[model samples]
Target: MIRLHHCHETRSMRSLWLLNELDLEFELQIHPFDKSLRSPEYLSLNPAGRVPALEIEGDVVFESGAITELLCERHSPDRLGRNPQDPDRPDWLTWVHFAETVSQHSAALTQQHIALYDDAMRSPIVMKLEAARLGKCFEAIEGRLSTPVENRDYLLTSGFSAADISVGQAVYMARHFVRLEAFPELAKWYDRITERPSFAASLPPEGAELLYKRDFYEVWNG
Candidate 1:
């Protein structure tokens, strides 16, 4: 049996979207994104107390990237994952993991904008810096997408894969803090990937509590 611990609009959304894309049967355990994660029971599943502790065949997987790799290997190898022998393997790995690079800034911005309720507890400088950093990540993606290639709708030359899902979900979160307007290629790519039914299914269910309340969180100017 496969089970995934998830929280609304967090990194776990990447794993959830991948699972949906793979058409895997798994149980979803929604956890409140708060101290409940730090509880001993939850910590046992993920020492870091992060969302997305996946249980498969009696083994638990932590980290979204690791979960994405394992799931693709077990279920969608060659389709969502390129084996080591494949030329695109290196690029696949790079893009799959790059999701976290984008997410780290989102995570920090989430903390600054959402977690800290009080204005004094939030740092305007940190918010601006992190949002600017997210723009850099978007620029990197824009460069990749802009590379001269025929039918370059996805990250990999082969086709759509977990790399798209991983980075797409990360962009989903990052977009709240940083607009995609400046990067036209990235914006178009994001819209294309997110239109997939699987991506839509990964969204938090109706009435479900959300980590990000606002559609956009503009950086504080103070």
Candidate 2:
């Protein structure tokens, strides 16, 4: 069985969601943030001290994006991945990479506003500027999703894929930092993704304490 070193409230949630989507049984080892991920034991598994590290056949794998790909390859290869032999492989690979890249930028902006920037650095002006930049990213997504209702569903090809899992999680996190209401198409897309059984299951129960808690610089001031 695969062993997942999961940290609550982090990108690790994506791994768990993906595993649940695949219906693969795996061991989950919770690594609470208060416990210090840099501990020698955790470091032995991932020198970077990140969570959602997977131990498969005694080999450790880190990075949420990579782990999602690995799980798809191992368990739900048919559904999660495109056939390399297919002529559409290029488009499939492009969408996969696009999901990761766009989501990274979106998540980075959130971290900047919520955790990385201080009060002196995060003025209203700065916040608006950052919001505008993030808005442009959503605009791009909105354009793609503007396709006719029947053709607008998934981020990847016709059906659900890892792209949806990755991009969906990033968009979910974006709500905490950016106002997504301006983009109707993106908002609709987000609503659909969040309603998925896998996505809904991944979220913590309402009012429940987060799995892992980190000190957000902005939260301290407010």
Candidate 3:
């Protein structure tokens, strides 16, 4: 049996989307995104105490990127993943992992804007810095989408794959901190990928606890 440990709108959403796209039958164990993650029970699944601890065939996997690679390798190698022999393999790996690059900034901004309970506990400088970094990541994606390649609708030339899912989810989180209006290509790509049924299914269910309560968190200048 395959079971996915998830928290609404967290990095784990990437794995959730992939599972939906692959049409895999797996049970989802939702956890509150708080100190509970560090509880011994959850830690047993992911020693790192993070979201997206997948149990498959009695073995567990942690880290969103690692899980994405393994799932695609085992279930959808040709479509969601590229074999080492495939020319797009390197690019695929790059884009797939780059999701973390985008998420790190979002994680920091999340802490600054939402996790901290008081204004004094939050750092305006850190908020602005992290949000700016997210913009830089958006610029990188814009460059990729704007590449002169014949059809750059997705990250990989071959077609839509786990790379888009990974980065798309990261963008989903990052958008709460940084707007996508400036990057037209990135915005269009995001809209296109998010329209997929799998992506839609990955969204947090109605009345579910959400890590991001607001649609947008403006960067503080103070």
Candidate 4:
């Protein structure tokens, strides 16, 4: 049996979207995004108390990148994941993990804007800095999508894959802090990939408590 511990709008959504794409039969256990993740039971699965803790085939995978690799290795070594032998493997791995680079900035911005409740606790400097970093990430994706290729639809020349899902979900979170209007290529690619049914399935169900209450967070000057 496969089970995924998820929290709405968290990085876990990446796994959820991939699972949906893979058409895998898995149970999803939704958790609130809060200190409750530090509970002993949750910690037993992922010592880091993260949102995504997958239980599969009597083994557990904690990290989102690891889970993406393991799931693709076991289930989709060709389609969603490029095996080591595949020519696109290097670019695939590079783009897949690059999602975290985008996510780290979003996480910091989230903390500065959402996590810290008090105005005194929030850092305008940090928010602006991280948001700028997210824009840089967007620029990288724009450059990739604009690369000289027959059809620059997805991140890889090989076409759609988990790499898009990985970076796509990270963008989903990062978008709350950084607007996409400046990066036309990135915006177009994001719109294209997220149109998949799998992406829609991973969205928070109606009435679910959303991690991001606002569609965009305006960063104030320090």
Q: If scored against the real structure, what TM-score would every candidate get? A: 0.98, 0.80, 0.98, 0.98
Query: What's the TM for model 3?
Result: 0.98
| Model 4 ranges off by over 4 Å | none
| lDDT, candidates in the order shown | 0.94, 0.68, 0.94, 0.93
lDDT of 2 by residue, 167-210 (tens): 77766655555667788888887888778788777776676567
Clashing pairs in 3: none
In model 4, how large is the Cα lDDT of residue 5? 100
> Which run of 10 residues does model 4 get worst, by summed lDDT?
213-222
Question: Would you list the clashing residue pairs of candidate 4?
Answer: none
Q: Compose the digit string of candidate 4's lDDT tens values, residues 72-183.
A: 9999999999999999999999988999999999999988888888898887888878988999999999999999999889999999999999999999999998899999
lDDT for predicted candidate 2 compared with the true structure: 0.68
Query: TM-score for model 1?
Result: 0.98
lDDT string for model 3 (36-97, tens) is 99999889999999898999998999989999999999999999999999999999999999
